[model samples]
Target: MSVVNPGDTVPSAKVVVSDHVSFEQFVVSRSRALLRTAYLLTQDRHLAEDLVQTSLAKWWAARRRVTGDPEPYVRRIMVNEFASGWRRRWRGERPTAEPPDTHGPAIEPHTDLWAALANLPRRQRAVIVLRFFDDLTEADTAKTLGVSVGTVKSQTARALATLRIDPLLKAD
Candidate 1:
C-alpha cells in the first residue's frame, strides 16, 4: 500500500506516461475522422477544426477515465459542443457562386444533400449525422445525444420527411 502525498513526486513510469502516449496516438489516428464528423455537424471548415481541437483537449483532460475506445466519447463531446452553440447562434454559410468549370469530377449530387442537411433543426441534424453518417444504432445515437430512443426515432422520421420533400434533393 502507498500513501500518495500532495507534495510527493513518486513514480514517473506509471499511468500518466502510458496514458499520455495513448492519448497522443488517439489524436493522430482519429483527428481526421473527427474533423469530418465535425464538419458535417457544423458545416464550416473553421468551426469544424475548432470543434475537433476543443473536443480533443477535453478528452485529454479526462483521459484517465477514457478507457477502451475513445472515439465515442470524443464524438459525444463534439456533438454536445455543437448542439450547445447551435442553441445560441443558428447560422450557416451558403455558397452563392457556382464552382468554376474544370477538367475534374463534379460534385453535383452532394451539393443538394448538404444543402438539405444544413436546413435541419439542431437536434434533427445531430440525429441524422449520428444515425446515418456515423452509422450508430438508435440506442447508441440516443446515448450519445442524451435523449431517449423514441426521441431519436421521431427526430429521424421528421428529418427524413423534410429531406424527402426538399426541392434541391428532389431533383437528385
Candidate 2:
C-alpha cells in the first residue's frame, strides 16, 4: 500500500468518501496550507491557529453532508468566521511597557505589505487574500465569500487601489 505523508498533497483523483478516515487524511494533508491562509486572513498567528481549528471543527461536524472538494467549504467557513467577529477575549495577558524577549528570527518578511493589508476593511482584505494570495478566480473568491462576482471584483479593485496609495507600500 502506498503511504501518505502529512505534508503530501491530497490526490485530486481520490474522491473524498464520507468517512472519518478520509476526513482525517484530508486534515493531515491540508491543515498547514489552511493555517497559512488563516494567518493571512487574521494577521495574527495565534488567531490564525484558532481560526483554522474552528473552521475544521465546523467542517467536521457537517462532514456527512459535505460533498466534492471540501477545501472550498472549509475556506468559506474560515472567511465567515473571520468576518463574524467571534474572537476570544484577551483575559489572560495584558500589554506591558517593555516587549517580551525573543531569540527566534522574524516570521514575516513582507511587513510593509502585511501592515497595508491590515489597514484594509475586512471584506476588502478578504477579497485581496482570496483572489491574489490564494490564487482563486474572482468567481471562486465570490463563492467563498458568499457574495456576487461583481462584489468580488469591486472589492478587489478597491483593495488594489488602496494598496497602491498606501504609504508603507509607496515608501519602497
Candidate 3:
C-alpha cells in the first residue's frame, strides 16, 4: 500500500520476489549514468551497452549474496569485461568486427581527444580511463588494472604526456 523509497532496506521478501520494485527503480535511476562509465571505458557504444547490461544481469543474478553496494560489483564486472577484451586483443585474438552499419544509431559526440586517445597504447588508455574518467583512487585503479600502483602511476604520467603533447586534445 506504500511506495518504497530508493535505497531503503526493507524486509527481505521471499527469495523469489525480494526487492523487485526497488531494483527496477534503482536501474531506472542509474542505468544511463552507468552506461556512460562503460562507454568511456570501452569506447564502443554497442560494447558499452553490452557491458552495462551484462553487469546488471550479473548483479541481478547474484542479488542475494550481495552484502554491500551493488554498484561496485557491477562496475568491477564491466571493468573486468573491458580488461578481458583488452587482454584478448593483447593475445592477438581479435573479436569479430561489426560493420559500422550494423549499429543502429550514432549516440556519442566525436572529439579531438577521441582521436588522440585512440592513438594511445592500450595500457595507457586504460590507466587514463580508470584513473580520470572513473575518478578511482590510484590504488583502486591499480587493482582494477591488475597492475602495481607504481605501474599505474607511470602509465598515467605517460598517458597524460601523450595527450598533452597532442595539441588536438582537450581536457574533459
Q: Pick the candidate with the highest TM-score.
A: 2
**TM-score per candidate, in order?**
0.74, 0.75, 0.65
Question: Residue by residue across 1-172, what tens digits does model 1's lDDT show?
Answer: 2634335675654334153456657677888999999899988887788788778877878877877688888999889888665424444433343222222333477876777787787678889999999999999999999989999999999999989886766666
Which has the higher TM-score value, candidate number 1 or candidate number 2? 2
Comparing 2 with 3 on TM-score, the higher-scoring candidate is 2
lDDT of 2 by residue, 83-126 (tens): 64545223333334212232234334377677778778777888
Task: Give stretches of model 1 more than 4 Å off.
Answer: 1-21, 86-107
- Candidate 3 residue lDDT tens string, 32-133: 878888777667887677678777777788878876566776777667666566435545876565212222233333565666676676567767887888
lDDT by candidate, in order shown = 0.77, 0.76, 0.69
| Candidate 3 displacement at residue 19 in angstroms | 5.5
Error of 2 at 149 (Å): 0.9
| Predicted structure 3, TM vs. truth | 0.65
